[model samples]
Target chain A: MARILAVDDSAAMRQMVGITLTGAGHDVQQAADGAEALEIAERQKFDLVITDVNMPKMDGITLVRELRNRASYRYVPLLVLTTEATLERKQQGKAAGATGWLVKPFNPERLLATIAKVLG
Target chain B: MPSSARPFTGASELAGLAPVAQDASQLPPALPGFESFQRFWDRDNGCWMVKILPGEYYVSRSEEAISTVLGSCISACVRDPTRGIGGMNHFMLPQDATQGPNDWLDPAIGLATRYGSYAMENLINDLLKLGAVRERLEIKLFGGGRILAAMTDVGGRNIEFIRNYMTLEGYRVAAEDLGGTQPRKVVYFPASGRARLRKLRPVENRIISHHEQLYLDSLGKQAAGGEVELFD
Candidate 1:
């Protein structure tokens, strides 16, 4: 089982991601916002970091930049989940060093698939 | 039993509909002039309370006495004493009406700007009609979670419209729970103006996006005056 960190300001979204990942046998930790995710990442080792783009304190793009700056997380798979889906935002994430993107309201299969692809 | 007592026998019936639970007793103290009825469900760290005011309607899988159905849609709990009776509505969209201007067209919308706006107005009118004093009434709003990805803006828009409408109407907003990337299961107790917001975990975004597309397509069909098929 892989260790994953999921970040989003919405409690519901955090619960959903936590449940799905745990059900899939992955050890999952949750953070309320991007800044919190960074704090957790610094203290723990995770196989992947899946975050939402829009958040209160720190956004996903900024989180990606911060994570990439750390040597330990530089090679960790980072995926963004968002509702924007605009090409501009996608490019912004890519430029920030995101490994890939997952659109919001995604299906269970796709979530697992993405995780497998990133961690495998 | 007082006029404000909810008719449900146990919390399990309500719990079957949503995952969250609340203790019945810690609910907000009822407003002085308002009659109150409440039901509670105990869960891990919190409890869910279903409170109803006199002349207000409560609907869902829990009881059949009220026709108000709850869904992952937007609902605005409004109380205007000038109109008297406070009421709430479960609406899916901002201005997109699916059933058309038929018997289902809630007359309250005429008083407010959109569905969310009308819900607040109708609720207040319900309270007023029931003998509530208009100037003394207050409003508490809830619901408007991001149920579908395609309609991400809908929930935000609903919350914004309610805030703006209240501002324009010169009403005080006592409390609010709005805007997030998760679907929420909400319970609004009109009598005490208490609302419980429980977030549902994000399943795959794919399912949510699919549902959003269907809802939007349905809106388009309604606008075109055609029968809207919600899903493929």
Candidate 2:
């Protein structure tokens, strides 16, 4: 099982991600926003980082770029999950070092399948 | 943002059947950030339609109407009349079999209540980002029925959570049709801030309940079987 970091400004979303990952046998950590996620990542190592865009402080794309700058997370997987689904936004996320993009209202099975492929 | 609750006008006219001529290909594309919703042309309603299911929302700037059916769930219809931008969200508080409805509010255990907040925040934030003014917003609430009779009054708790949320945010509610024994089908026009709600009886309620329960169950971990490749 992978150790994953889940970040979102919405408490409910954080909880949902937490429950889903934990139930899947992965060790999960939570952060309320990108800044907090960045702070936590500095001290701990995780297999994957999933984040939401449009947060109050430091959105997900910025976080992905920042994480890539760190040696430990240079090759770690970073996924963007948000309501924004335009081609332009996906391109922006890809440029920011995100491994993949999943739109909001994600299906749980689909999310796991995607994660499995990335982790492999 | 404070505004007088505008009277619910044009609901009947909006619900009246229109002769639809556009095919699926002719329907306008969904607004940005709402690409996941099922968008179609509703022949019965005579307009472009977007249908949102549990744990989903759709925002529109065009002339499309959003629709959903609720069973022990709630749908919030919010829009900025001046900007002609609005959206609808359907959500339910997570259910814990061991805890009572109000007990889900405990910070450590209240994931349920927080999910409701997440749904509203996302919908409202999307509207604001689309150039909608907060004070000019019109809000309407629907759903929350005692359809899940075997379980705790989750529907009632959902109603309380949203009402308290609106009050805390200083948003005024213009109209609502909440708390009953039957499921409801709601169709809303965000640009016009109009809605048509019809309560369903036994036949549809069973279907709605089954779907909602499946949504809740899917939130838990399941066997991974499908393939979804990552784009790198």
Candidate 3:
């Protein structure tokens, strides 16, 4: 079971994610925004971090930039979860050090499958 | 597999999660009376986009209604029932977001031209051009949610300003659902003089907040020679 940090501004999305990831035996922690997620990340370790691209204070792309700068998180699996599916946006995330991209409104099966593949 | 899976064994992050977990647990009780969540999110949005800023309004003679999602921002739907013409306007507050508390009542910053006074006058003027009789205008207002949720009660101020404006202007307000914590999804039909409002859930509120925040952020960036695009 992987310890994953799920970051998004939506409470419902976080709860849905909490329910899904917990059901899969993974320890899930939720954060409201990138700034909050960064605070939690600094204090604890996670196997992977899933963050939405659009958020207040700081965005996911900027978060990936900051995380990648840290030596301890240099190779951490950072995934971007968002509704934008344009190639340019995906490339932007990839360029910003995201390991993979997951679309929003994701179902439990799709979310788990993505995590399993990434964690593998 | 990437180097990220190198098995760094560590303790759970649950120890310091009391408040965070409490907030997650308190996300508004299964959305009491809303329609199916999927239905609301996945409905056909084939209609025209009617998003307006502080001093903009769109009056329509077409049968279709103009829709907008509002936060602490307020929207007014005014129409003449006899002529079947109406419109909607969305405004953030009486003045610019950057305005200070001391400048709250700055008369030098004309209220009619700004969102507070102009937003209503603009919509009323548009309806008049589309054959609405001045004496038969019926107004309906929605929004004024505590979206900022900060120490400053801007939403309450906005609600009060609009109420007083209508009272002074002497427009007959047929219906109003104002001032609550939830952002609203409103559809104002110009031809039928009908209005529909849905008190959105937190997830839906996040969508609206994100959109407006980006727009507001863009305004700041644009003044400094930066461009911010609104994406769906």
Candidate 4:
């Protein structure tokens, strides 16, 4: 089982992501926005980091950049999980060092499928 | 910048039996449901239409029906008892900010409407053109459910935005059914200024939220800002 860090400004979206990942046997940690996620990341290590794009204090794109700056997170799968699906936005995520991108409103099956692909 | 784009979009009229056509209708190149408007139809209601978020609304005098599904989103039905003109709007915080809604009021009236202020103005302006008087306007607010147990105060902020807007405008709210853990299905009858709200079950809420989130995700900054849900 992998340890995952799920972050979103939305409590509901965060809860859904946590439940889906945990049900799949992965341990999940959550944060409300990128700033909080960054603080969490500074101390703990996780197999994957999932985040939404738009949020207060800090956004997902910037968070990806910051996470990538850390040598320890160089190989961790940093996924951009958001409702924003534009190619430009996706490209931005990649430029920020995101490992993969998943659109929001994700379900258990689709989320798991994507996670499997990312982990592999 | 305070923006002026509308959040709720689509040709004001739905398919099945079209309402009196109007100018600048948005349904073109016709996205699946956009081609005909009527995604769902109910026989007894004359013809029924639905609104997606950030705010799609309509005013009707026929025996027609207007509806919307909510997930921490909001729907406001404004009617004129005197002129018998009314409409409903469904909107949420612009794109992903969900910040202090009132903070946007000063910048652009258009941007604020994507939240509540502009929705009220847009619907009220239409109602007035249809002969509705502010004093005779009846306002009813619905939705703002806590479907996302992990989210911040989005639902509460939406409620606060409208309330603050209405109060600032000196409009006495007729009624409201806000807050809770369930998303809502709201129906409004324009001719009679009557409305009905159903708290959707958890199963249905998840399905709808998933779809709406996809809709939100597919949006660009200006449009997705939830600024002009018409940006939808």
Highest TM-score model number: 2
Candidate 4 lDDT by residue in tens digits, B1-232: 2223433223232342343333324321222212444434443343444454554666665545678888887888888877766778876655443333223432222233333443455566556656676668889989877787665666776677677666656688788899898888888877677787888888787776775566555432433122100010
| Chain A superposition TM-score per model | 0.97, 0.97, 0.95, 0.96
Clashes of 3: 0
Mind giving the per-residue lDDT tens digits that candidate 2 earns over B1-232? Answer: 2223532224323675333346778767678667767777665566788888987888999888999999889999999998998999998876653333324454323545545665787798798778887678799999989886675787898898888777755789999999989999999988788898988886787788899998777643211111232564
Model 4: runs farther than 4 Å from truth? A1-120, B1-36, B39-41, B44-54, B95-115, B218-220, B223-232
DockQ of each two-chain model = 0.01, 0.16, 0.01, 0.01
Worst 10 residues of 2 chain A by lDDT: A104-113
Contacts from the true interface found in each model, as a fraction, amount to 0.00, 0.15, 0.00, 0.00
The top-ranked prediction according to lDDT is 2
Model 1 per-residue lDDT tens digits across residues B125-192:
34543566555766666555555656346666656566666665567777766666776555654444
Q: For each prediction, how big is the interface RMSD? A: 15.2, 7.3, 19.0, 14.5
Q: What's the fnat for candidate 4, on a 0 to 1 scale?
A: 0.00
Considering the two chains of model 2, state its CAPRI-style docking category: incorrect
Candidate 3 residue-wise lDDT, B96-204, digit = tens: 4343222334322222113355445546645654567667988888887887557866567778777766665566678999988888888776777777788888667
Better of 1 and 4 by lDDT: 4
Across A1-120, the per-residue lDDT of candidate 1 in tens digits comes to 999999975444565467668878999999977999999999998999999777657889999999999999998999887554567878888889898887643334456777887787
Q: What's the lDDT for residue B140 in model 4? A: 91
RMSD of 1: 20.8
